[model samples]
Target: MDPFAPPPFGAPADLGEPDPRDRPARLAVGVVGAGRVGTALGEALDRAGHRVVAASAVSEQSRRRAAERLPDAALTSPQEVVAAADLVLLTVPDDALAELAGGLVATGADVAGKLVAHTSGRYGTAVLNPLTRAGGLPLALHPVMTFTGRPDDTGRLSGVSFGVTAPDPLRPVAEALVLEMGGEPVWIAEDRRALYHAALAGGANHLVTLVVEAMDLLRAAGVGEPGRMLGPLLGASLDNALRLGLDGLTGPVARGDAGTVADHVAELARVSPEGLRAYVALARLTADRALAAGLLKPEDAERLLEVLAD
Candidate 1:
């Protein structure tokens, strides 16, 4: 069946998930926000053979993404998308998700019995209670990959984990969708959803900030190609850290080289006070963890702690 052509509306409801072989024709998907994430996912679902019927884009970038990634999907309002979809993906920002769902409810839209999912990492199904209370089936499906608002992003979804939170009866539905998108589904308890999201953000987002800060400092220190200079070191550090946990730590802190660490602190203090603060704080924490991991001796760490505190 052509996805642009809607499935006949009178099909009987099947609360259970559709079989993998029948999913493409059995469900009609809609996107409530045609931003980077929304378009990429719509493309993924479309690639998995699901029919993307419509999507809503409020900005030029979103509109362009929708045009590129979801060309056949009608550029329609959220209400229209909700009306036509058997499964509606609310992919707006975290701050706007609740309000958007509330708007859909307030408008008395026909969301009843439809599978409604949101791509908010910080929130679980609770943020979608407004929809569920109105008879919509709620599921939280936060993709654990970043989006670049590019057409090629759909390919990157393969093999990444998707943090899923749904009711027991709907677990299969959530997992099946993630699998359809070429992702692993990790069930996240609703209460621990925030922590799950925080771990991802700290690892991904904060890591990016840290790398950029290092690059800035390197450029200031007369390095012409900061990225080239740090790429191998950062990559090896990340690989070792993941493979060996805290035991993978290397550097002055891990070796408890107080003199070298104090030299770093003094140089950073002279050149960049902000960088010095960050260096000291991180080195202190690294030393603490190192000692606990038996990588640093008490006598060796004592002098390092004094330098870090100074």
Candidate 2:
């Protein structure tokens, strides 16, 4: 099976035997922040037989998203939403999560005995200590897919991997909720959540920058429809990297062609000086990986590294 291939739509995640800590099959769910992630997950939960009873939406855009995707859920205040549901999803921005949890507790919200989960890849359950102190069962469930808040957002939930962090007693509950939403739960330890999120950002977020830069360079060189030219190449490169790791590397740096790499650096610096730094940095890293992977000999890597440094 290709690791890059998405799972079949509606495929069930293998959760093995059910555990005692698992909640009832149907839950009254509330969303504390009706952002893209919140509404999408709320809709997915509704499709999974859960009742989306309430959701808090401050912005007009968020309120519209909640109305469109989570039609059954009433738009209310965060405190009211928490008070009305068995499970509450706090899908605020990463920086806002701790404050939201803390504020919920500060306002004397009825979080006691309720399952409260936040969708922040950079955080673990520890960030919800404020709510935990108030007797709320805190869990972190960060979905590994990007959300655009479009109608198709709910479909993206199918077969997605959710980074989950929960206490031992609530592990079953976390996995069950992920499975119910058609996502595979990948358990992440508390101490490693930040690193895990960083890896994701480095890959997905930076790939966009790299691709856009490439497209810009191509357009500058008078290549019309840059996407058409890059689509197959990028697709194959991604698949190769997934399958072969560093051994999949190609191009001048990977082959230790110092002259070609030097020419690339010279041309970019001449025409697109702003992108020169990133190109050099990535080339240096690629040369290191290729050298370590035995794809480039030490003699060739020495020359390659010299070109990048220059």
Candidate 3:
């Protein structure tokens, strides 16, 4: 068994990378959860020439998704998947990863010598300690993209960032694998995994919540098409914020319009108290960032802070 040789049988076809890195030899991969992320990643790895031997899909929806996304791979149990594969992709929930790994190890699965990876954003290689202790090579591959379990979801994985956390010895192997998956590897330290994941959740997940809340408020205020109203404004805002960061901060908050801010707070308080609290919290944070960015003067922010505090 040559280390650099591709999987002899039961592997998918070969592929290329975005950044023109070398596509490493394919491994016998097994996905231990056929959820959205798991199925998509398994497909992507298959496209990268890896042999997806089997996948674990419990729910009906998951089984269907696995059949769709991982058609080449057989459906089976987690322990079987772990045992059969050279690389095991454990794409379970964050909370379930440890227990799953422990259970597999306890059941005398051959975790040792396998590249045991999990697609958990909140954790790094640390969460795969059970596998590691069992002599498995731990890899944390977190794609910083949302999934819909649709047909085209796998195509979107190209040219994206993957928060990769692997041991120093396995760094090249992990990164090469990421490149083969058509993603750039953003090395995340074991210690900073939580913060790294937090930042992503704060930006992506919280942005979704904020946008939905805004739309709800718009609907509450008798706006017929909340999406239409917010579409362009949010598009530009997001573009600017991505390009300019705090310099992109705008609205009454950035301008330090205390009375206007007060009016917003009062209106939200009257109409939607939930929106009011969020508005206040975000506005204060925006104002603070604006001041720090030198976009807002001390004297200008004083009244705004006073109104926000009130």
Better of 1 and 2 by TM-score: 2
Candidate 2, backbone clash total? 0
> What would the per-residue lDDT of candidate 2 be over residues 244-270, giving only the tens digit for each residue?
888788899988899999999999999
Query: Tens digit of lDDT per residue, candidate 3, span 1-310?
Result: 4322222232224344442113455577899989999988888887776768899988999999998878878898888898789899999989998899889988988876778889999999887787788888889999999998888888889999999998887887788878878899999999999999999999999999999998998998899999999999999999998998878878888887899999998898889897788888988888888999889989879999999899
Per-candidate total of colliding backbone pairs: 0, 0, 0
Indicate which candidate wins on lDDT: 2
TM-score of 1: 0.91
Candidate 3 clash pair list? none
TM-score of each: 0.91, 0.92, 0.92
Clashing pairs in 2: none
> Candidate 2 — what's its lDDT?
0.88
For candidate 3, give the lDDT of residue 257: 88
Q: How high a TM-score does candidate 2 get?
A: 0.92
* Candidate 1 Cα deviation (angstroms), residue 190: 0.4
RMSD of each: 5.7, 7.1, 4.1
- Predictions ranked by TM-score, top down? 2, 3, 1
Better of 1 and 3 by lDDT: 1
Residue 292 of model 2 has an lDDT of 85
